[model samples]
Target: MKLASLKTVSNAHNDSIWAVTWAPATEARGALLVTGSLDESVKLWRGDELEQDGVHTGHSLGVIAVAAHPSGNIAASTSLDSFVRIFDVNSNATLAVLETAPSEAWLMQFDLKGSTLAVAGGGSASVKLWNTSAWRLDASLSVLKSDASVKGSEKTAGKFVLAVAWSVDGKLLACSTMDGTVGVFDVSRGKLLHLLEGHNMPVRSLVFSPVDPRVLFTASDDKHVRMYDAKNNSLICAMSGHGSWVLSVDASPEGSALATGSSDRTVRLWDLSMRASVQTVTDHTDQVWGVAFRPPGGEGVRAGRLATISDDKSINLYDYS
Candidate 1:
């Protein structure tokens, strides 16, 4: 896929736009993009222009997580206060406020079926699963360990989960934590399954391949994105070029390419097979916090689409081909 700048909404947010997700296009609204910022606001954009469609508020601290319910009718965002706000993507009305105290919050995600919500439980060293219908936390898959040095540590767990992803089948959930641990869990059984190892730094972003359940990609402060054999927890390839921390990552609908935003103030597009960056978007003047490849749908929207948000308080929409 190639890259083309579609639009740049300057001062899109007052502070860092730390998280983003694409709300699948609906018959009534078309596909929309949602983003959460450190300024404590969630903003929505309309059409291909990426104009401000609306804004949702109530977050008390930096909004570090945002996820669209698989159905695209509802979306959720989480902040440092450890609150998850589920709201109507169209009317912008609050649906439910989910809270898990005693545990910090980080990246969030909804199952492919839209029946469940999964959250990376930051300080709790676990991934919290919630029943979407009741909006109640159903099970907390704790990162139990027998690896002696970690199991009994009192350092408050640098294994603080920072990001998570669900396999395309919705059967597997992988969580990346501050301690550089990638825990692949079996959600149906609420059990810890396997741990993927490679990076020694905090893993900030994770995404399961849309086409391959056996494959997963992760970005970290180590300035590398490694493709992994999820089932076996084996490293497949390492893609590195970012000069600073890679903050967010997502794949296109076709699964042939992926996008990453980094603290180096650039958004990069990578060819999965080549394990190399094909394009570097240097438009953002500050650290790029998030990047997403819009899902393929609707009647005739061709060309790949990539959306990026930055600490510079801007949102950039790029045409990918």
Candidate 2:
């Protein structure tokens, strides 16, 4: 499979675009592209033509992460100021604002059921779960630091949680830390299951395979993407090629492929079975910060789509086939 450039939106934001996700289609509209930027605004783009649908402004600092609810009508965004704003995707109306003060919010994801939203707690070393129906704090799953006396304790100490992902079944939650440790949690029990260790630098992005809940993929500042069996806490394989930090990663809906964005200013398509990058796209003039595969659903939307945002202040849409 390859990605064909469908449309490129230059200056999509006043500053660097840091995050992107596809809001699944509702009966009223097809899937919409949601992007958050350092410009302190979150914008929505509709259709393959990439027309602007709405621009949301409330963040005080750079918008760092954006997540779409499974229901498609609601979405959430978080900023460097440590606030999560949940709003209506179509109307841009505010639904709730979650203030994550003591622990900063980094990346976030709504569970597949749309019943809970998990926010990566930056310095607290935990993942905070918010109940969707009441928009209340449900639970905080804490990741314990490895023994300080261990060989590489200095590098792992006082690290911040940077990224998070949910398993296909929503039964598991995985989060990555600035020190490169990936912690897997049992969602129902609020327990840390295991830590998948391999990368020595910060891990910025990770995703669980859509087809297998136990399989996970991660991208790191170590300039490598690693696959692991989360259930067994075993490293499956590690693929490397990016010249700089690998900033983001997403698994295709079919689970046969993976896509990554890197500080190397490229987007790479990986063939999962071969455990190697099959194609590298150098479309951005600066660092690529976010890459997302469009979620399946919506009328007449069978063709796959991939959206990528970058430090170049551009958004690129690709036909993934």
Local accuracy of candidate 2 as per-residue lDDT tens digits, 138-165: 8988887556666554543656899999
Candidate 1 lDDT at 321 equals 83
- Weakest 10 consecutive residues of candidate 1 by summed lDDT: 148-157
Q: Which regions of candidate 2 fall more than 4 Å away from where they truly are?
A: 145-156
TM for every model, in the order presented, reads 0.96, 0.96
Of candidate 2, the 10-residue stretch with the lowest lDDT total is 149-158
Which residue pairs in candidate 1 collide? 2-321, 25-31
Q: lDDT of candidate 1 vs native?
A: 0.87
TM-score of 1: 0.96
